[model samples]
Target: MSILVDKNTRLLVQGITGNEGDFHTRQMVAYGTKVVAGVTPGKGGEWVLNGKIPVFDSIRLAVNARGANVSVIFVPARFAADAMFESADAGIPLIVCITEGIPVQDMMRVRNYLDQKGVRLVGPNCPGLLTPGEAKVGIIPGDIAIPGNVGVVSRSGTLTYEILYALKQENMGVSTCVGIGGDPVNGTNFVDCLEMFEEDPNTEQVVLIGEIGGSEEEKAAEFIADRMTKPIAGFIAGQTAPPGKRMGHAGAIIEGGSGLAADKIGALEMAGVQVAQHPEEIPGMLK
Candidate 1:
């Protein structure tokens, strides 16, 4: 069984009328996810995407009327934290924040509030999570993935796609692939997803696609070294990124010598995880 979502997951799209919202919402609905309702504040009385799903004014109304337990936020960055808190207050069990550009301070505050309220958050600036051949919660390219025994967790969106493509080239498929977001302060971390994968019966091996960022990877290595029973292969991106400058990922910045690619690679290697020097080498390491 997959963690977080399954065939029974009922989803709600916040900002379902926006370009990003409408596009991914249609894809998700077509992929067999139960998108029960949507929310767009003043656009409550209006319909979205040919009126396929009902749109409401707030998370409270959406959850109250449609039993929406999971929410995917496509709202803009400035309002993402507010959306998250709204979902939390509405008692939504799972909230995926797909919006990018949310300030770090705002994320910290939101995270703290979520922790206090016991809410599960997936991303702040992420591609989102997918249970292959099942429900998808974010913006990941669903076409590239197929359901199988391998589980994947990544920080970078495009890099997750690259790793999945590589695995597919090797005739391997994924049980689940989670883009846990590239934000410094996110709801789920590598270790959190790893624990979920470890308990998932369908997953045989795991792939961690990370990038130069906070000490999250290093912390995950320590956790894996001590607790994980599954074989893990890892690849850290941004090897060529200039120091102190953010790479393609918002969280991929080197500060105080902490978030260097080499450092994360070393930590993973020391934890007995196979480290892929190049992205292409990941599938080989997994095999």
Candidate 2:
């Protein structure tokens, strides 16, 4: 009952020949994701990862030849928007863009295109999504996840990993973990994953790992209060972060008091979501 990916997810890597792309391709294969093919323009007709994956000239070719329904973009940020458009044009239903620093305007167009085609895009600066014991996409560590009823959605990569580890350590495994990316403009948002988690029968609880920026968390809290019935826990980072400073992530900038950690915490608390002071406290709240 995984939401986005499972054993049957035939995957395509858009820039599979490059350094980051190649490394993660191998990692994904080792984690048992059905990485059927890769796309690297001029490298077509070639084989990557010791000839295990065939390289295609285009996403269309990869989808045509490999039956790839999902695609991950490891291409540089400058070309990430194009890669996303290409995957959508080629009819890839699910796309995960790991490249960071993509211009906001480019993503605006890409987002519209994806919406028009009904594509599910995970990120542009993200750790990717994982369905424990089922499929691994993006860069999430496969070992930290275990198939269970709790669904996790996060805005930070490292924080997501930490939460997953704590959950597994406490024997509270997850159904799906989605890193929706922390960029100001990208594909997917907290509410989108939350809704999916709400509808997933396998999921009994939900965990939201948000940061001190963007009303995305606040918005998600509103949705949870109104529509979601699943028990949810939350942990918002950057509690003491400097105001107006961009904290590592492009979207983690605290402007005025709108996107502060305290505000996020208060909103989630008001929505009846247990707010955890630390990720370790999250597993306990799920109980």
Candidate 3:
């Protein structure tokens, strides 16, 4: 009952010949993800990982040959947008983009195209999603997550890992942990993930980890108040960050006094969410 991905995911890796792609592909395989195929353009017909997975010249070929329903992109920033377009055109329903530093203008176009095509994009600068004890997509470590009822959605990659580790230590497991990314124009938002989590039968509670920048948290708070029935615990990062400063993420910046940490926390609290002061406090709050 994971939200997006699970053990049945037949995955294909775009840019699988590159260093990052090759390395993480093996890690995903080791974690028991059904990595059926890969795409590396000129390296078609070759085999990687000791000849276990077939490499294709394009996503269309990979999908047609192996029934790859999920595509994970590891290409560079410059080529990421085109890779996404290719995947969508090739009929890959879900695309996860892990490459960072993509131009905002490029992502704007990508988002529009994906919406028009009815495709789902996880990230252009995200850590990807994890379905514990089932499938591992993107770069989220598979070791820290175990199958359970709580659903996790976060805007920060590193903070997601920290919260996951703490939950593991407390013997808490998650159904799915989605890193929607901290990009200004990235695909999928907190409200989207929250909706999925709300509809998922296996999810009994939700933990939302947000940072400064963007009105995403505020928007999610509105939705939580209006529609959500499950108990929610939250943590907002960048409480001490000064105004007009860009934090670690491209979208993490204070602008025109709009994206203050206090404002987001207030919104969530008013919606009846238990807000945690620290990442480690999240597990207890959820409990």
Residue 260 accuracy (lDDT) in model 2: 92
lDDT of each: 0.88, 0.91, 0.93
Give the TM-score (vs. native) of candidate 1. Answer: 0.97
TM per candidate comes to: 0.97, 0.98, 0.99
Best by TM-score: 3
Candidate 3 has an lDDT of 0.93
Output the better candidate (2/3) by lDDT: 3
Candidate 3 segments exceeding 4 Å error: none
Give the total clashing residue pairs for model 2: 0
Quality of model 2 by C-alpha lDDT = 0.91
Per-residue CA lDDT of model 1 for 1-287, tens digit only, reads 77787788999999898899999999998888999999998888777768779899999998989998899999999888899999999999889888988999999999999999999999888888788788998888877888888899988888889888878878888888888898888998999999988999988899998898798999989999998999999989888888889876678899887799899999999999999888898888775
Q: Enumerate residue pairs that collide in model 1.
A: none
For model 2, residues 1-287, the per-residue Cα lDDT tens digits are 97899899999998999999999999899989999999998999999888889999999988889899899999999889989988998889899999999988998899998999999899989999899888899999899978999999998898899899998999888999999998988788999999999899999999999998889999998998899999999999999899999898989989877799999999999999999988888888986
* lDDT tens per residue, model 3, 226-255: 999999999999999988887878899999
Error of 1 at 119 (Å): 0.6
**Regions more than 4 Å wrong, model 2:** none
